[model samples]
Target: MRGVDVLSTAFKNAFRSRLRTSLTVLAIFIGAFTLSLTNGLGTGINQYIDDTVASVGVDDVMTVTKASEEEPTDGPAEYDPNQIAADGAPGATATALTDDDIDTIAGIDGVESVEPSKSVMVDYVRHDDGTRYQLSVAEFVPGMRIELVSGEQVDLDASDPELVLPESYVEPLDLGSAADAVGQTVVLAVTDATGEQVTTEATVVGVAEPGVLTMGGAVPNDVLAAELYDLQTTGAPEAETTRYAEASVSFDTSGGATQTEALQDRLADAGFTGSTLEDQLGTITAVIDGIVLVLNGFAVIALVAAGIGIVNTLFMAVQERTREVGLMKAMGLSSGRVFSLFSIEAVVIGLVGSALGVLGAVGAGQLVNGVSGDLLADLPGLTLIAFDPVGVATVVLGVMAIAFLAGTLPALRAARQDPISSLRYE
Candidate 1:
């Protein structure tokens, strides 16, 4: 038979044994649906992480700290009575970075520069006719911008003493809403280095929404940071004034991954450790990816079981069609055409099963999202099962390939049957 004729005959023949073929197709459908749903789950979660990562921190910048110098000893090392600390610097007990450490970091090759993290020691924060509350303030780091509820973000490069208030702080400060809080000034009281109380004021330029990677507190412009740092250290001797909690390290990544790793390696060897934002989220992503992989394993086992079903059904079809195969051969049909005909039947089953499974999965995904969306209202931008067209197409093609492989043995058996022996048997 011609190829088209063989395909046409195969299509018609597939449904001749409706019950058996339907059972096999149903088996394949279950496997495909499971596999596609699992894939979509992975895709949705990873995509959400990627979106969060954009606000997590700057990819080119890494947080750095001095490697701890004290090694564990059986007993406390010989005390150095002469080990003196700068008069106003951080206490020896604290892991305080100093100007010298910053200088050392800047000296490293491939290092751009370092910005020391300024700790804003606020005694109390109070808004117009509102109760005073203790609050923590953080400087606006480049690339780690928070999602805005209203107004605009703090311009880190600008010298204005602008602050982005957190949503949680809105009601406490008597700010009715994000829009109402904008352009309002709040008073911040702190104890300067001279042990005297100092009060500073900053304008509320914006309000921030909650985010996974944000500080969850007030974000201040560079001017506020500089202002607070000066007040906290003013009148203290320079030797005691310049201390840092940690520092932001910037490096050139134009050298690509290899050079970026090399730079980090060099920093490590120099007694300083640096970690990019990805490093911070590495463990989280690893755990998520591992769970997704385990779920996918179960889906694949189902697909494998479906393949066996395909094999059994094709074998049964080959037996039932033996007389028909003999008759076709007797009419001058080539063995290759007979093989093609059986293979096409398997392909047809795969196509029907995959189409049903994929369409069903899409509908089920919508139902799951609708049911769970309100239950997970806090987790915005999350779709538990989300499909990618390419991923869905890949699953379909993979199932069809498995079906084609399963039918190979049956096709070969049908092609090898002797015409005279097969015709006389029945």
Candidate 2:
């Protein structure tokens, strides 16, 4: 028979048992829709995590102080006065990282760039309004994650004290407009390495967009440090100045697993032991992927139930058509034709159901995203609900394949019917 004639025959047969055909198609649609939703949600979540990590410059690694090997010293007897506080006991000491450490790490094979930064907690006040905030701040190391949104970045060697503020902090202080805040003076109260509250003034040189703060709240670090030095010291002049205890190192290329291992070895050789951001993210992604795999597996149970429905429906169709199969054979239709007709009908049901399933999944995804927008508005990362064409295609094809397989046995049974016996018995 021609393709058009076969299709027409298939449609006539389906229409003769409209309720059964409808139920079979509905089963396929539900299965395909559920599969699409699960796959799309998983893809969206992974994309969100990747974007969040990228925003933070996940390629960089930070080196901080390790636990001390030496035991605590007693009495001030052998202690260096510079290392001891006025109380004569060991004072609050900072990490020993210095330019020498930077030089050592920079020499590592994979290292592309390194920036040293230090942070201290302090009290800050607006010069004009005198409003105070307990601020933790760090200095700008040029060519780092923090980018200047207004004005210029602080000059590394400039004598004048300049500062940057987190964009979020700008509105609360009424720092005028972005332009107005530039060149304005703000006062910072901070403790030096020796631990004394010192206050000094600095120009608001720039502002950073939100999500860029690495260590603490979004106060400008350079301004805080310079201001602390300007404040008059109440104690002896010989007090040690606080230094940055760590450095952020960025590589030229994405090292993936191999690069991470090489970088860790280099860091260990330089006498620093700390976790890489990439390694931590890898661990997190692995855990999340495992959880998703398990959840997807459970969801597949629904699809299996729908598959079983398809099998049962086809089996019933075969039983109903036994005498029809005998008539077709006596009318000169071959066994192959009889089988082809039923198989074609099954495929038609699957195709139509899969198309509807795609529509349903797309609509559901959009609804979910609309409702979730408000909850995710303040979040720094990508949203988790999304429509992915590849994932939709995969689900549709998978359901259709399952449907075709479910109909196979019934098609074979209908084809193998003995024409004379089927007509005589029924």
Show model 2 residue runs off by greater than 4 Å: 1-16, 49-104, 113-167, 176-247, 254-291, 329-344, 380-383, 424-426
The candidate scoring highest on lDDT is: 1
TM values, all candidates: 0.77, 0.67
| lDDT (Cα, tens digit) per residue for candidate 1, span 36-86 | 888888887777777788655468887777665667579966563323332
> What's the CA RMSD of model 1 in angstroms?
6.1
**Model 1, residue pairs in steric clash:** 88-240, 89-240
Model 1, stretches more than 4 Å misplaced?
54-57, 65-100, 118-140, 157-161, 185-202, 215-217, 222-246, 253-259, 278-286, 371-373, 424-426
Q: Candidate 2's error at 150, in angstroms?
A: 6.1
- lDDT (Cα, tens digit) per residue for candidate 2, span 331-354: 888888878787766767777777
